[model samples]
Target: MSTPQNLKLPIPDVLASAICAANRLIQRLAQPWLVQLVLRLAIAVPFWKSGILKWHGFLQLSDTAIDLFTQEFQLHLPGGPYPFPAPAVVAFLSACGEVTFPVLLVLGFGTRFAAAGLILMTCIIELTVPDGWPIHLTWVAMALAIAAWGPGRVSIDYLLGDRNARW
Candidate 1:
């Protein structure tokens, strides 16, 4: 039997060069600024959509949003699934956070703060719907990544010379 090291087949010169070229192309396309921008947009969209749905007009929480918080959502914690305290207040705050944080994220203004807000929101969402952990975990991961990295160069933070400052 051939050992693992001896079992490898050699790549053809043309194939090796093609792979290198592809890697170089990918590196060029996936710049840090572009990756950061995409991350900001990707994470912002869902929150923004949810936020807009919650509002009937400026500062107005829709009946559906209020009703959902009061009737449907709960904190699935130890010993009991607790109803959200002050559901109206919670719903209004949630709506505001969902709206405001996404705009900050997309603009890359207060990007880390926005990401941290999203992280907090994700944690609350996880408590509310334990079954949605898969998606919630993804949101947390994106938010944490943004928080750790800060917004990249294509951002208001960068333009204002505040990019390096921890928000």
Candidate 2:
């Protein structure tokens, strides 16, 4: 068989390809993915630690735990179904949720679920609890962003692929 001639790329094709590759690289670098990860991790780690404290304290604050939480922030929750409105189950659940959610969020696994919980909790906190009324709202904003934009490239969400995507 005759050997095929060596292929040569036209100058225009080479230049165009180079420009396209460069543009792609720049776009990746300019993405706010890193910033999102940093922010999520920053909030998640601290939230997880504090949740540990709440978890341990759950036994002592069995009754009116919700009240105590609201009190810690100097606020109150309205009447509602709260695991019988006693035993502080809601408080325990809340603490565990915060801890668990951050872990999921940081790892990018079940990010949607984590974000949803955060949004719900923060909304309640904003509406019912805290001297700092805006604290919950702030978290809510962050949660909304997480929900809307999703975790960045380094997240478990990326690795798990669309099969795990909420959308």
Candidate 3:
């Protein structure tokens, strides 16, 4: 393809030198650990706190729980069930998942799948339960980052050579 005369370069060396400099700059800026750290902190704090509350027997804070817990806020799921089941253990498991997933995410361990699970749960809370928009947003963003970037050099996934491996 012929270059447009107006766009033609007078000196290809200038372009080549610029390109090389840009490449070096990119490598210097490629701090995967920093990116992962941001992902861990921004995503995990709320999750860990919320999950810890539930783990401490707070029960599911879903629509049913909201209505029951605070009369000030009327709540309904329309077709939703409570966060907890009759067995109690199911709720416990959910709590543990929420609690532990954040820890794993913070540590960048199996980040993608962990983030994916948490993201699914958050989407359920946001879409089905309708009370966790911000939290869901946090999870969705971080989960996506984890899935997109994999864990960083600071992560167990990286140390174990699973950074590029998918769940």
- What C-alpha lDDT, on a 0 to 100 scale, does residue 164 get in candidate 2? 32
Off by over 4 Å in 1: 1-11, 165-167
Off by over 4 Å in 2: 1-30, 57-84, 163-167
Give one digit per residue, the lDDT tens place, for model 1 in 1-167.
Answer: 89998876656877999999999999999988898899999999999999999999999999999999999999998987999999999999999999999999999999999999999999999999899999999999999989988899989988988666343
lDDT (0-100) at residue 108 of candidate 3? 77
TM for every model, in the order presented, reads: 0.90, 0.62, 0.61
Alpha-carbon error at 107 in model 1, in Å?
0.7
Ranking by TM-score: 1, 2, 3
What is the TM-score of candidate 3?
0.61
TM-score, structure 1 vs. true: 0.90
On a 0 to 100 scale, what is the lDDT of residue 56 in model 1? 93
Ten-residue region with minimum lDDT total, candidate 2: 80-89
Tens-digit lDDT track for model 2 on 32-108? 67756765786577568757666445344333446575444332545632323432565777777878899998888
